[model samples]
Target: MCSLEKRGDVFILTITGDSDHRLNPELLDSITAAVAQVKSESTPSTALITTAQGKFFSNGYDQAWALSDPARPKIISKKLRLLVEDLISLPMPTIAAVNGHASAAGFILALSHDYLLMRRDRGYLYMSELDIGYPIPRWFVQLVRSKIGSPKIWRSVVMAAAKITAEMGVEWGIVDSAHNGIEATVEAAVKLGADLVGRKWGGEVYAANRRVVFADVLAVLGSDETVGDSGDADVASVMNHKL
Candidate 1:
């Protein structure tokens, strides 16, 4: 589920999901149109709010799709990777206005932001991939590396599919701020983004800094879906877990 609405100098991007906590694809192009509209109308200086309609951001993929048809995992993940990479490269700032828990691909999606904020009462942040026997992509590891310098921490997140609290996310730098509620968190994120933009002197200086940080690593990051796939056994294994 996705929808875009103009909010003054910013755009609100809401992730939508079905009743079962899966991406809504019963109709085609609905989400595509929303993302396109944001890209077309929003200014480069504008900020984006990455939130979800319901208590869950997205389970990443439909349970039926992931568990039933093997190819569905690869297909949907490829599209999802493309979309996530696009968000990472967006000239404007993107904020993770996390209203609820985001796991697996959802977790990586949230971390791609320039800043992140989450509500304290939101659902749990868990990586369900490892529980399912799936090996997360190297890019996911890279994103975590950008925040947390320890590979061991990421290895645990990747291997154990650990669930994290919002408060813990802030302490670990996974999220910029974890407020008591979503509305306040949103306002705070926008203020932080606006402050950064207002303080910026020249585009070249900031651009150069950004290039320096990401340029060296760009070559190391392979294709978005360079990680291996999760077969039926993997899905079945995840399904059997308490997570």
Candidate 2:
């Protein structure tokens, strides 16, 4: 589902394939495992860049798979929540080389990074829940609130479900930079990662500061309360709406 490669002090975690890297159980587990590996093996100067080899960075949750089992939605939601926690607590700086479309959960995954570099040639950042009639999760709202500074932009994203392009993403402060293509975006991310690694910042110290900065987000993710009970009934409701 994914592979990790180290290039000097920068580690690249790539979701390999031309398909939309759907956030399913297997894929989520693979990503979480990769993050754990990065944590265990990282040095002070190490940095991470997550990218995908495809036309889609990730389309979103694997709804078809989610609908197959009543408990699956909550399972995937919990996994995503934990993965966000892992990314936030990661010692080294993180960047997302968004080479393709990032929708819903995929958007959240990209936003979990410390910085984002997107391709200008194609792809868009989109939050599809509103359009699809799904209630946006509370933790997701909090996370988006933390990342997006403008209330107007936040509304556009969560309420209007605007498909944000690379130029707009940079202009709106959602992404650090925009590049010409997928390879260019990844290159920019790697360069940015290298620059961050050059700072030689202590992993523990950086992670600690990040915790302090996003303490509210962390708390919400840890909380029991969500948009719903995240139970079978909740999953059923969600599926019904989709239908």
Candidate 3:
């Protein structure tokens, strides 16, 4: 489901296939392994760019698979949360080359990165839980809250289920920039990586700084004993709503 390649100090992780790139167990495992590979291979000068093939960056969790197995949902959720935490703490600078639609968990995945670049010609950054009849997870809300600074954008995304285009994403501080297509987005990410590498920051320090910046998210992710009292009421109600 993913491939890792190195071009000098920049590591490109691409999620392959024409599939929707859902976060099933197998795919999630593959992604976790890929991140581990990047961590092992990276140096102080190295950086990482995550992109995908075809029209989907990721469509979120594989609902059909989750429905088939009763326990799959919790497993997928925990794994995804851990994956985002891993990405946030990855030792090198990270950028998301959002090639296409990033919906639901996919949106959160992109937000987890240090920078986000999208294709202006196609695709959208959508929080699709409302439309899909799924509850948005509390950790995900923490993610949006940490990464995105605009309250208007937050309400629009979590409550209105806004389908944010590339340009709108940039305006809302959700994405760093918008490019013409997948190739352009990746190229820009590569260039950004190169520039950021020139800062000469140690990977460990960089990762630690990120942890501090997103300390709240880390706290929630590590909180296994906590229950209730998260995010907002209206959204949490819908998220915990039983069908």
Candidates 1 and 2, the one with greater lDDT? 2
| Clashing pairs in model 2, backbone N/Cα/C closer than 3 A | none
Per TM-score, the best of the predicted structures is 2
True-vs-predicted CA distance for residue 146, candidate 1, Å: 2.8
Would you list the C-alpha lDDT of every candidate in the order shown?
Answer: 0.63, 0.89, 0.84
* lDDT for each residue of candidate 3 in 1-243, tens digit (9 for 90 to 100): 899998878999999999989888899889899999999888876799999999999988776776554445667777887898899889999999999999988888888899999999999999987887776667788988987778887999999999999999999988899999898999999999999988888999999999999999998885321123343343333334221
Q: Looking at candidate 2, what is the lDDT of residue 127?
A: 93
**lDDT by residue (tens digit), candidate 1, 16-124:** 6544245323311354466567767755456667777667765555656555554445555556655655565555666888778787767766776667788888766
The full ranking of all candidates by lDDT, starting with the best, is: 2, 3, 1
Estimated TM-score per prediction?
Answer: 0.78, 0.96, 0.91
**What is the lDDT for 99 in model 1?**
77
Q: Looking at model 2, how many pairs of residues clash?
A: 0
Judged by lDDT against the true structure, how good is candidate 2?
Answer: 0.89
